[model samples]
Target: MRNNLHSRKINFVQDFLRIQNEAVIRRFEDMLRQEQLKLAEADLSYPMSLEELNTVIDQAEKDDRNGRLTNADDLKKEIDNWE
Candidate 1:
């Protein structure tokens, strides 16, 4: 599923890059923004269960132990280089 999602993302970028119509580009941008807003709102609407909270904590602890963590400054620097 992850691979499929990644491939779909690449295809979407390819499709987006081929677009030349200004109106179509504006519509795509609006739709994408709306979908992202819906996703964010949905996340905030959910109250985490005790089990879910514990799972998140466990993942963080594992990440810490495995040294799979990024500090805020490093993350911000990385984000600045993103397209």
Candidate 2:
């Protein structure tokens, strides 16, 4: 049952990707890149003290509330312009 569900999910993703235009696929890739960067940054900060981690989390919340974060699409455009 677990394998069947996994297979179905994989098939669904495959079908979705097959129908997406190049621009949509590129946008999806950019989103994945942004997520990868966030994960990498989190991983690098793994050795932080509890207080430091809490401070970092609080700062992230503040930035989010203040609209200080860049969206994946804008980041991708900025990166592309750098090339």
Candidate 3:
């Protein structure tokens, strides 16, 4: 019974270390990607402020609730008619 408990503790420690290593690797990969993007001169635009995003979302929800938004198929049909 004591041996079994010791084995379980070892297994738990191994699992913990594995997860920690994986997290560190993921962070390293992310840093590398960011560095590559910087080297490539990618335009890293800042996202809209929370208030601005909230306003956009609110407007979209309102339009959806009021049936002001067109369905994809319907919009396509309308465009076809125009053509």
Q: Pick the candidate with the highest lDDT.
A: 1
Candidate numbers, best lDDT first, in rank order? 1, 2, 3
The lDDT values for all models are 0.98, 0.91, 0.85
Report, for all candidates in order, the number of backbone clashes.
0, 0, 0
**Tens digit per residue, CA lDDT, model 3, 1-83:** 99999999899677656775777778867988999989666544666789988999999999999999999999999999994
Lowest summed lDDT across 10 adjacent residues in model 2 is found at 16-25
What is the overall TM-score of model 2 with all chains considered together? Answer: 0.43
Inter-residue clash pairs, candidate 1: none
User: By the TM-score metric, which is better: model 1 or model 3?
Assistant: 1
TM-score of 1: 0.63
How far does residue 44 in candidate 3 sit from its true spot (Å)?
A: 9.0
| CA RMSD (A), model 1 | 4.5
Residue-by-residue lDDT tens digits, candidate 1, 1-83: 99999999999999999999999999999999999999999999998999999999999999999999999999999999999
Clashes of 3: 0
lDDT of 2 at 68: 100
RMSD values for the candidates in order, in angstroms, are: 4.5, 13.0, 20.3
- Please give, for residues 29-59, the per-residue lDDT of candidate 2 as tens digits: 8998999999999999888899998999999
Residue 5 in candidate 3, Cα distance off native in Å: 82
Could you say which candidate leads in TM-score? 1
In model 2, residue pairs whose N, Cα or C atoms come closer than 3 Å (at least 3 residues apart or on different chains), thus clashing, are: none
Q: Candidate 1: where are CA atoms >4 Å away?
A: 1-19, 80-83
